[model samples]
Target: MGSAVSSAAFSTRPGLLDGLDPEQLAAASAPRGPVCVLAGAGTGKTRTITHRIAHLIQSGHVAAGQVLAVTFTARAAGEMRARLRGLGVDGAQALTFHAAARRQLRYFWPRVVGDRLWDLLEGKLRLVAQAANRAGVATEAEVLRDLASEIEWAKATLVSPDDYPAVAARTQRDTPAPAAQVAEVYRNYEKIKNSAQVLDFDDLLLHTTAVLEEHGDVATEFRDRYRCFVVDEYQDVTPLQQRLLNAWLGGRDDLTVVGDANQTIYSFGGASPRPLLEFTRRFPEATVVRLERDYRSTPQVVSLANKVIGAARGRPAGSRLQLIGQRPDGPEPRFAEYDDEPAEAVAVAGRIRQLLDAGVPASQIAVLYRVNAQSEAYEQALSELDIPYLVRGGERFFARKEVRQAISALRVATSRPSGADVVEQVRTALAGVGLTEQPPPGGAAKERWDALLSLVELAEELAATVQDADLARYVAELEQRAAAQHPPTVEGVTLASLHAAKGLEWDAVFLVGLAEGTVPIQHADGDDSAIEEERRLFYVGVTRAREHLSLTWALSRNAGGRRHRRRSRFLYGLIPEDHPAARVARAQGKTFGGATARCRVCGGGLTATLEVKLGRCARCPSNVDEELLERLKSWRSDRSRELKVPPFVVFTDATLVAIAEQRPADDGALVSISGIGATKLERFGAEVLAVVRAAGRG
Candidate 1:
């Protein structure tokens, strides 16, 4: 009550405890000492944590500048900052562990290290390659990549090269090479990186930890600067990250963390739910709150999600969240058994079509699968039906460098106090930074340009679609995106891997390719822990649906093929035998493990149809911008027809690609394209620029 934020300003913000459920209110109000909020899927974890920070600042317990909130992703951090601003609090630092560490490293490296810090490598591959060569380990590009991941895992788990061989063997890690060879490569990598004075992302935390552990003054300053700390996704903290966090905290205990142990799906990436599960052990007096209400999904969807996770074996005792659905009742989840993969994809797409026709926005529908390979069939089926869709890859969206840089610029501009509208402010901030009208044909430079252009379009959209929108409002929208992992509503259905579907929700969700080997995944076959993770993944997918939820599995890989596949084991005890799902599987054929397949119902011997993802999946760009670039291309396509010339004649693919990537909106911009001279600009500049302008206006 004694904080700088006056009662008048705080009253208008209903999000601070006023709107919180009882459990959230308890977690948010207990803004002192150690607090752990066990947030379930679909629960308002972001809301609760943001409100807790707001309450701490607004109620005078902590100043906004003294509080630090950390999440796992840039977008999530952005989301927290936006929400705090909405609650009339500002100046708090909400960032990913890497972002926070990098900020500190940038500031203190000179003072602590007595010189500038080493260049942080954007990627580890080039360095890993050199290390492989130095260590006499011959590797192709793919093998190099796998080794890079192995190195990352070792670093994340705080394992040294000396530790990796034993650790990998102990954990049964599927090493790309023999454990000893991989460890040798890892050692060479460290030696090379040190010699070159370069550090990879994981090293960012390692170096920071070393600095703090080795330097007293820097650690003191960091701890003083951030008195109160909040960490989101506590379940997914790698051991290296926890070390960095501990270094930041020094000996302080003013911390709050939110996570669900049951949602621990990133063990392969060195994330464990142990920190969340054992929070009370470290701080015996810690206030632990469990958020069970499922606010994002219908009761039907929530019940199914709860059921799915309920069957998971070997889960830590009391770790699972028994979700209590809070939304109005919706239809029971639908289950289907297809004769083949093609039939399943077609059936899923057909139902999606019906849902789209009935008025569910394409953006509110998603087809979630276990692995990227399963997407091909759905992609073909959706394309055949003339449905627009996005196939999501692995990389986190807001973690892109261009996006982070653009946001940093926006923040700087916001601090200066701009006179222009939100969109204009963004454009001015990004003017020469990357949002040029013309751009390169390919590579990172073009990707950077496209990211900035998308931000501009996002600003334009907010300015037009929102009432009296400003930079603050635009930031808030980004916050919403960060909180949900939902990008701006693209005008297409989303096809994402289940891991990609975490922290996101939809009105209609179709979970496809739920056969045994695909769902539990072949790698999980021998490991109980890995199998449990797969079950958690299934729970994540189930909870994403708000209304219509259809789950399908193929009995075979091809039409009229041997019915050797079986439904996911996770689905077995969840869906009843009398259900159409089980009936259909029974009618086709039921097969579990081994080459010899037997029908579950009739005891008939059947041939096998292998379900594979890792071996069969195709690879593609892991990061794609869903921005005005796509819209500009679509508009350019229309112009191609109206000009009464072939599309290429109107503008070569290179020029058009440039136009789309740059989102050029003026004559100067158009003429700068590779093939677009003054003549072409005179002919089609208005048309091309108009698309960018329209995209800006939403």
Candidate 2:
């Protein structure tokens, strides 16, 4: 509280952090009631906050465990922790709101929740889902699953069943069910959870807030423990999260929140940026930082994103998040419309194969869509083409019973140090699944659950040796990787709903299912804001493409000849003046695809192929040798099989074909090929050239 403590405790010299500008540093270092960083994608807002945390800790202002950094996702939290460690502040508690809530609930479950909570909650949900299905409220299991999600969201937003009709009538009234029914269902769910003496995910935060509110001393303890806080993706913080944040701060804490108002796409989940945007007004001492330099995308992609955003007038203006396109330039955003879903899928698959033949890798390509429903076509095509893909934001890892049980066991083992919870939960969930027929001999369950228990034990040992601040992060990261076959798709070729895909970027993005009832979203047209949001959604989708961008729309979908729908308004907006799509809808284009070449003599297709990304039509004089193409394709196929990614993904059909046709004799020749930019050349240039040379020899 004294001048010496204030000056000595927290200070940062300019240039200590990489990626952040001096302005960002000043804003981040400022101790204040509130600070807002309005940054575009990849301008290093993340880097700024990270260094800020490091500065706070190193200056002796905020103790290691006293600083809390909250992110929108568990993965993002892990990333921030890792980055902070890189900056020499390894112990800051970087966490997602839900994760923090979970910790709080677990630490005080006995006092706040009593002992009978867990079993009661689970049984209640099970019974409700069963009854709902039998009562014809929801006929199918999938419908029940959706209902369960709705139930959770409603509760998390603190919406009571009595409040459902009013809330539902006010927001998204067009949804199928009446507000009263929704309210009834919610009422039932609460009853069930209470009867079972258990809490669902929502209850974690709600109960934590309740505990803090009721126990002033405990709230004060936490506030004193973490004097400084940083939250990333602040635009998406829900009301529940805001409550938690308020509770943690105890009305006064140094806070830094960074987000883009344009990226406020998670409103369905109760996420909003009003809190972030209003920070300065709400807290008189708040400082605002705006970042416009886009280090993640190309000028072309950024310009398009800007234009799309411009089309939506209401959003708060900030620095333009431009794209500093990293990969070698290949193609601009493409626009295409197909006859139907299957044909569109086929075309996309063939394009990948062609790109593979040229030289682009499967790992560098992604097929993104507006909804999960659209993935079916791409999934089928990729499966047929033998493409290996990881879907992003598809399912929550904790939602998987197996993964949850495993993680819970791991947490228990880590918490107890001696591995008690691992023994308890595994036995409990296993018994529910009928995995354990009879009670295990004393300690037998713990011994049998070796895989998870061992990890818990390792975490326990890690905690003792590692600093407490670092122990949580260490455990979180290990659990993240160990909890699944794949880390929930933070990277790779991301297949995501446009909504979920809002904040991320990729090397090449293929936007599929750009048809009506999908992009504008069937219900989004009535409200002007909704329409603008749709446009913003399209903009979000297009901006995700760092280099190559493609949009595809199918006229129809035929599942056993039950023909489906029309082109999406989004695609309709892409047609050129002379194109038919323009007449029907306002389509414009500097379209990527024009015409497919066919041989004049044999009428055989003259498919243009790529060697990585250098494209050449079959008729191009610079084509690689036929035998070389065969060999390169064969080798690539083998690698693709091993990796499980589609062959096109392994290498674009175009890239493969270019290697064969343009037999790059050396590095110079290789660089001459398209898409063979500096990074690719440095990473795989020698091997790629060797493959070309060897193929030519064979």
Candidate 3:
């Protein structure tokens, strides 16, 4: 293990160190030379990495400043840093690859591009995009974004443009981009970046590696300064990131990396674990550690997660991922099916309410979905129920108008000696918030800028007014932190689409919109690797459940009552046939009533249904025509959309069917139906009453 032992063996610390697991201890003790830690979900992969960093620092094996820890996301880096600080070691560098690349770029920009190059070249790429669009090239912003992402993926994987076709062909298995075009753009983009001395997100790493590899003194200085490197999510490293890591090592080859190949889900984004997998091959002297015991899930849930991954391709079998249950006999992962989506939403809201009543905190629950569009139903349901929930990603905070305006003000006021990272932050925030449309004038916009900059001015004045240096310091630190992570205004529950939910966890997770196309995802089925990635997504959703996991899907979406959705295929073979949901499916049969089923009033059978109910049969006549039936239902549902509307106000299928069947000619008769309460009768009583009377008269 190279003499870096567990905290328990050291007998130096008290709280956190005393409770270290053996796997964690082993991870801490292993001497670094391209180390790879393959662990299952909740097996304390994060714990092992954090402790190892702590051990390195506490043992004086590396200076805090010499240690560089790279994570896949800014949030993950922040979390790792917080954990390290809690262990009383604070000097180590913790940042995302992007952040690290930006830092290094700033350090070497003067030499790379001479003086004053960054400012003039700012947003030139946007101009390029505009020109490309104007020139009648493929220019839809969305298409450009996709192409830009394609370029980034190639760069990140360290795949030169020439290699893009073969690699993309193999990895994508379908929809491969033309190799020649990729090469041309790759060449053009590089030329532009070099000439302008500016870098896009990927160029940060690409150029930094170039500068370091070309300059021995610069490389050596960085390598010697950072003797220890700790990497989290090692499975996600692209070739470019690996090259950057090699440059950081500067041939020293001393480092600690923690990752799990099974949890590798970013392959589509051009991230690969081959570098970590081939770590020993490259160094010929490296250690590998496996952490399989999960510390977060129950035996049953862990078993489910393990079984799903076990069925996946390319993953090793023996080291199956397992979960360690924290509570005694938590609820089993339940599956439910509904005739339509609104019912599913109501059911999910009902489940959350039940959990809350049983003692789960609102913050403890998270509702995850395959995409942001799927969140609409859950948000609607939650709003109706008055439940508090936060979406994980998307432009919630960054998209707010007030917040954007406020940040523009702050950026201008705090624009003192701002480094590249700070400048990028301000630029991104300003541009994202739509302030760029009427941006403050460079020199002429000073007064207008200060006018909008009142928030920052007030905060500074407040800091000056406070007598407690500690309080003032705290305020200043908070201002800096806010300036870094949050924009001016922050409100509403997080609304993260699934792509944005990576590297994050919540207490109670509701994975809504778990339908076939959305989950395996419509686009994922074309490739085997992509399918495996989808399985990993399910794994991510499952592992995210610290206590409760609820999975749901809708039979229909849209206001027109279009019903053409199927349950997620990923859940097909894994969940047992005897499960409650399977039995429900068996009962419903393969084909069921969908949206636009013929009105019982008109006596037409648009779609056939098995005899599962009493009121409507294949032979019955609908009270009103199809359009009238649909209109009545639409009116009823619209009322349901209003906050605080009682359940009965929204006519249940049974009640609607009864009204259609009986053709009630008056309010007295309509009020007699099930679920038609006094409140509903008073508010919508006349509407229903008139519909019935009109139907009878016609």
* Higher-ranked by TM-score: 1 or 3: 1
Residues 425-501, model 2: lDDT tens digits: 33443444324544333222322343333344444444444454343454476665543322332212446688767
lDDT of 3 at 252: 77
lDDT of 2: 0.62
Clashes of each: 1, 68, 21
lDDT (Cα, tens digit) per residue for candidate 3, span 486-598: 32222223345666666666556777777878888888877777898898888878777666666777666643266688888777776668866622232223222142333
Least accurate 10 contiguous residues by lDDT in model 2: 582-591
Candidate 2 local lDDT, residue 446: 24
Each prediction's TM-score against the native? 0.74, 0.68, 0.71
In model 1, the worst 10-residue window by lDDT is 609-618
Give the top-scoring candidate (TM-score): 1
Over 557-639, each residue of candidate 1 has an lDDT whose tens digit, in order, gives 87568989888888877776677673333334333222333432344543322211101111212122246667756765787
Give the CA lDDT, 0 to 100, for residue 172 in model 3: 49
In candidate 1, residue 48 scores what lDDT? 90
The whole-model C-alpha lDDT of candidate 3 against the native structure comes to 0.62
